[model samples]
Target: MTARPPLWRDLRVIRAAAQVAALVAVGLLLYVLWFNLTNNLRRLGITTGFDFLDLPSGVNVADNPISPGAPLRRTLLVGIKNTFALVVVGIPLLTVIGVLVGVARLSTNWLVAKAAAIYVETLRNIPPLLVIFFVFFAVILQLPPPRTPLVFGGLVVSNLRITVPWVETGPGADLYGWALVGGLLVAGGVAWWRTRVYERTGRPHHRVLWAISILGVVAVAGWFLLDGPIRPSLPVVDGQRVSGGFSGLGAYYAMLSALVLYTASHVAEIVRGSILAVPKGQTEAALALALSPFQRLRHVILPQAMRIAIPPIISQYLNYTKNTSLGIAVGYAEITLIVFQAIGNGRPAPQSILLLMGAYLVFSLTISALVNYLNRRLRYVTN
Candidate 1:
């Protein structure tokens, strides 16, 4: 055989050298940018460190009260908490609405399908910022003032705020909380056992019912045994303000409503496309087995469709989380708003912006990681 080319003259060596040169060039460019940025900041008399985080943030956060002398770190934590609150509530609601609309678009009923189509087209086409403005100005601000707050049972609604009845934790609540966690673990075990049983015996598995019943029994028992660890607290109007229960700022509601409607429109389209991508033969097979429409969907269609939909759904979730930054427009005190507030109050803009970007990057990466894990679990295991 002919002698192999010298290592220095090899194609692989040339490719490796090219990659190293490119990386070095990119690093030099970044270093130059950093040097210029630091020089400019120094010339402008701007301090460039995170030490400011220890100083007090004198701004008032709407709906969440922090002491005027509270540290900037505390203020940021509150902002993060507010953002998490939106994500926690918004994701599930969007999922429910999107799934409903998506399925409706495929419905045999002409009106239902057309209506869903219109909803998806109308909301998705509009700018999300415009949606936020519409909800804030046209819907939320139009409600009656606190003095004439609408009262329905345990809920109070007004242009200024909305309040709903919520569970109030009392003494021994910590013990009951731990007990509830234990109950959940037990319920999960029961679900796993039921699933295993179904797998082994090919029997109908009512895993959901089993899990719910187990959890409910433990919860009720714990509630009584721990001597009422929690009780319901209803909203009560106290003069110009509402007290008791869980209160939501009008700005919070506006941001949440707009993001949910806007994001759900996109999610609906994703779901519809994923459903269509599922094999037609699967639906036929379910029908031949005499499965009802709902059963066919739940057992055969949705499971497969979800695997396809989850990747794009992850993108929608990230978009929703980022769009929350637009809450600044409506005066919501999300992280971006709080950071900008700090900057306006003489905090270093560069550092505050860096922190803000880091916060969002963390959120995006976390969501991506979680969805990727689920995707792997749901992915097909082909031979």
Candidate 2:
């Protein structure tokens, strides 16, 4: 180190000095912003602390269990649950639709390819809000009203709500549920055991087959032993009232359908591009190896394409999660809707807005982390 340069002249020391200065500047800026915000809010006669969260939230979310007098904190959590319901259901449905459409886009049949292209182009160009509006007003609202609802067996449809047959737990339900959990644990243990046996003895291990067989045996035996712990709850409508089974609100379906279709359009394009990005030589090699087309696509194309596709798809997921706020239009009470409702009900606007931002940040970060973990697992590693 050339006999220790002057502290200020040393590169490491200079970097450290600059970092400290930058950190100090950032800290001061944050302090100033917070001070200004608090002062402004104080002047406006708003409580700046979070004690308001413990106060009664005199608001009720439609189709949700949150009562008007519930604590604000509990109300917000219930809103989060409603939002997460959409995420869980919509994401899987959209993914399946996207993958099918993407694969169809690459089909050799003219009709199939053209149809997929038209779907992708038409939906992708239109704004997502328009899609949501169309689904809500034109599709969902256009359904026959509650009194003259359409029905097919256990399925009941109307502009007000859609009801479907769902499982109702009976006396042995809790025990049956625990039994299933135990089966899952046994399956997992068996799989690990099989893996270790394969590693030690270098033998073929049909671990998945064994695990599924074990689980299936447990499920069937438990069902009979527990004397049918679950039964179907079929819904029926009487005039404007609907009861029995699980009733889904028209607004929920409208928002879920619109968001899934819109996001799937973008996902379709991502998937198509990723699949096309796979080397043509890989396909040719697959053909040379005498693999069937389905096998070739399944085993060779998808794995590679998925690795390329996931990074961009991560952003799409984050976008979709944020876009769930649009459910407000259809009156599906998600977190954003609830937060706004709180603000309208004399809640502090600034703090409520901050909480809304934090809610979205948590959702987005969680999705990003999960997808990034998958991407990492799928990536190729080398020495």
Candidate 3:
């Protein structure tokens, strides 16, 4: 336009030049910060590299089999595993409890509604660290000692540890496991097929029952076909020590319980608010159709509420995962605890901290990515 308004004086050219200048300034600032950090570390005689990852950790993690002679890399892996263990179990339990409490908060029964309100108010108001301490000292530590543990079939509980029945892998277990996974895939396909049929014919699909039955049959058949490659192992207590099934450290339970209760309180509130946000017209329409309360909720309300709830729940999940670092206070060997342990043992503090941050960053990003994917799938498609 008019010789591009002389390129140097053009608004577009000036904007581009400004952006380049800003980017260069930001890059220079970052470089300067890095240079200062390196110089300071060098003067302090602290190694800033990751070569220490290959060296022996010289410390054994509780509830893990990592030897003191194992490399720091292995130690960190164990820590990551422990953190994952907390998250994997905590998330589902929290979801179940949160949903129950959330629905209860809206119950017709005054007692139930009040009780849920009290729980949500109390727990959410408390600091998560305080919850962790309360769980550790006032609850878990208050259990009977290991010498006289609570015993209920395959489960054992004590202040020292808790143990539960778990599957014991035997020969061909891997193959059988893979077969079960294939069964799940088949079941999912069956569910999708049922969904399509229901959409087309307006029939009762009972997709859940069909999927579960398919999965169960395949799993049972695979178990027999593989000659029982997995069996249940019950916990056995032997005078202050437990063996046979899976054993959880007291710290694990404390961290898990505290985080679940605290995070679930937030999740409960989110869920309750989401449910309330659903348009009243939708509920009235469902009622006009003579739908029972449960049917109304299951078919008309929950689906929409969940779409709203999931994004916030994803944030709560990340919060719980990060709060797990507080396990250090109770002696759980999560990644943060492990990093601090290494640092105290003369490892390079900066590198260990950098790795620790990276570990958590990876965890958060992964959880966010997965939940965001689900959110996208659940989102309403507007034409």
Candidate 4:
């Protein structure tokens, strides 16, 4: 090879130098901006630290009263918890709805496909904020007031709040939780073994049935071992104070319902697209095997479609997470609401906003990481 050119003329050297220069410039710009912000705040006699977390937040959220001398930290945690609750409940509900509707859109039956199309078109076209508002003011707020709350099948429903029986964990809760995880792992192992056995001996696997039975047995055994560490908590409303079960404010329901339906529409479209992306030959091959439609879709199509669906689905999860911030509109105390409230109550805006951003960052990264892990596992590999 010829002698290398000088750093000024060499392509690799120029590329490296440009990247380093850009990074240094960006860093210097950020530092200058930070210094300017600090200088302006100091001149205006404003503080910028998280010391505000300890300051007393005088506001009472929902029916949950904070003592006047109580630190803002507790309130912040509650807000974060509310945000977490929305995501935990909403994702599963939306996913089931999305998959059902998506698959429905591809049905051979005219009515089913048309109906799914209508649903996807209607919701996805409407602004999510509009959906939330309609759900809040027109739907949830239209329910009977708390004083005349409906009681049916252990559920309490009202314009003020919706209360449902949720599990209350006891002293053995942590250990019992681990036991549940163990049960799942054991169930998965059994399913895998069943698949292996079927492959070896050409027997009917029925792995789903086996997994469910194994999991249920383990769960029941764990429950007995822990002396029922998780108990049903039914709402015991004694005037203004409600105890026992989980209670969500009407705003919470509105937020959750609106987001779930709105997001499901988009997810349905994604699923529909992913299914279409699968090779037509694959479906034809399944048909050639004399497989019924359900068998063809279930055993052949979905597995491949899901692999395509997962990568884009991760984006929907992230979108749903960030969209929870919109909860602030309807008086739901998600992190965004509480942070803004803290700012309104004389907390440092910059620091509180930073914390708010960080919360969303963590939530998005966590969801992305989990979905990415699943994506990696499901990724197709060929020898």
Candidate 5:
């Protein structure tokens, strides 16, 4: 066999050719996109620059407290905050509920398994927007109007809003902060102590109980020392309005609940599949060792299952974050809505849309990065 060309020479030529071809393709694609964008903007009399971002976004953002006179950038920021709020709150709630439902679907009880199965099937089939509408109309709007709100102690649940107690910040704020710091230290100490006890005796460690007791002791002591610095901001009925306390507007609750329910269905499926993917031998081994189902799930099955579950669950989370834009349909004033409003009110459509896309892209990539880190940490490592 003739070695016509040395390996290095041949590889170098191939690499050079591939790089040139890839660069040509990328250049052409960018050229086309730029051309189309500028051509369209000029045709529509819209500026293609970032200057529009400085213009006042002259529209009242419903449910947002920001002034309409604020710059377009501020409006966009408020919208981003609203979107982030939904995702941050919804993700944890959905994940917990989904995990419970997924586990229930595997329960020995016929009723529980079937009920969980029904919920997953029903929810996953429905369109998310319809679910949002249903939640808003049937649950939120159907409640008694703001005048005669449902009251349970300091809490008031109304058609227009739900109000709950919020501690009014007082002069003893520093005391409360120190109490929180003390609680953290105490909780950490309790956890460390529990670990030591578990190591020494190989007994069940009630780490949660230990941590809670420590934190509770610190908090209760701080409460008395602070001399009732925090008090209830109760909701009061004022004619046609419910005032006082922190209110969750009907649209906010509706949008959050809808996304949570929708995302939970997908998360439930992922949990079920991940759990099932865990080796049957692991479950059997736990049983052979006389482990209770809860202990087996907690210690043996879940750790393994979580490795499988996290990647897909991360995707669901990203999807939920992106889906928060759907809140615009119900007037929830999320990022997408604000972008559209800005464009309508003389902000350049191209630049505003680009910014909106960039925001979502950043949110998605950040979530992916976090998930990748967790995946690396959890992945099986063998020497």
Candidate 6:
């Protein structure tokens, strides 16, 4: 009797068959999606090419310089830029706050831990939209209307704007930009030197000190060398609306703060769970070595817990990014809001929605890819 084919050979055949089946299924699904899109587009007498992108978009965005006469493609690009601004700003702020709250939940003090738990439980259970609304009403709306601005030092804060004295652009702005770039490079080099010192001497590398000092030195030198070309654009207490200085609108800050807080609560829970999941022996060993609690946590517990925490943290980031779309209710003008407004104004809903989805998909996937790369680097490989 002929011996049965080797299991490895059979397995290959089985895998090949499964792959073919999957491909067919995927092809069928894509065909259905394409057919539906084309059929509906045709039924509605809509042209299906991306040519609509070239036509002038007849809508205006708040705070953006984009005029209604701008091409639809340009409007979409502005929407994308707005979405990116939120993601870039929100992710770092939320991550820092989340990690702090997560660690706080594990605090030895009963009150601290309980308070953290309450915060997480309360915020995580509520809808993000409500949180946005609450933030708008409670914090932003309470700000003095633009007429009577609250002045602190030189900064002016009010409902219509939050203006801080900023480096005013003038001639030699190009020189200032170059100086800033040089300062950053110097700071990076100093940080690298500090790392080398730490590696050789096992001393606490004050990379932060080195970087800050280099940056400060360069900045001061640049200021004088340029004859004070960069003057402060102080906000004046003009009637109602303040002029000059960079100001973040009340709605923008409200949306950003609410989403950050709402998402941080979920991140806190993930961190707490990950910390608990760490092997108890690891903590005990650190204690046996007489490591201080904070040092033990920073060096041992957190490093390990982070490996577990990162994946979930990426999810929270993605959620926060997507939730920025809900900023429409608060007039944030993120991609989703802009797209919805466009659709409401009689643009092709399906294509606009598709573009919106694509924007989010890119954001989510890019974040996931970065996290996954870091996760791989941090993960312990076992045979």
**Model 5 misplaced regions, further than 4 Å:** 1-12, 193-210, 380-383
Reference-based TM-score of each model = 0.95, 0.93, 0.92, 0.89, 0.90, 0.89
Which 10-residue window in model 5 sums to the lowest lDDT?
Answer: 228-237
Please give the distance, in angstroms, between residue 312's alpha carbon in candidate 2 and its true position after superposition. Answer: 1.0
Per-candidate clash tally: 0, 0, 0, 0, 0, 0
Which stretches of candidate 4 lie above 4 Å from their native place? 63-68, 166-237, 240-244
Writing each residue's lDDT as its tens digit, candidate 3 over 1-383 gives 44568878899999999999999999999999999999999999998888999999999888777899999999999999999999999999999999989989999999999999999999999999999999999999999988899999889999888999998999999999898899899999999999999999999999999999999999999999899999999988887788889988999999999999999999999999999999999999999999999999999999989998998999999999999999999999999999999999999887788899999999999999999998998898999
Model 1 Cα shift for residue 184 (angstroms): 2.6
C-alpha positional error of residue 332 in candidate 6 after TM-score superposition, expressed in Å = 1.5
| Every model: Cα RMSD to truth | 1.8, 2.2, 2.2, 2.8, 2.7, 3.1
Clashing residue pairs, candidate 5? none
For model 1, the superposed segments whose C-alpha errors exceed 4 Å read 6-9, 194-207
Q: At residue 182, what lDDT does model 6 achieve?
A: 89
Candidate 4: residue 169 lDDT (0-100): 89
Clashes of 3: 0
What are the clashing pairs of model 1?
none
Write candidate 2's Cα lDDT for 205-324 as tens digits.
789998999999999999999999988888877778777879888988998898899989899999999999999999999999999999998999998998998988888888888999
Which residue pairs in candidate 4 collide? Answer: none
- Collision pairs in model 3: none
Candidate 4, which ten residues in sequence have the lowest lDDT sum?
A: 61-70
Q: Assess each prediction's global lDDT (C-alpha) against the native.
A: 0.94, 0.91, 0.94, 0.90, 0.87, 0.88
Output the number of the TM-score-best candidate.
Answer: 1
Candidate 6 wrong stretches, greater than 4 Å: 1-15, 194-208, 380-383
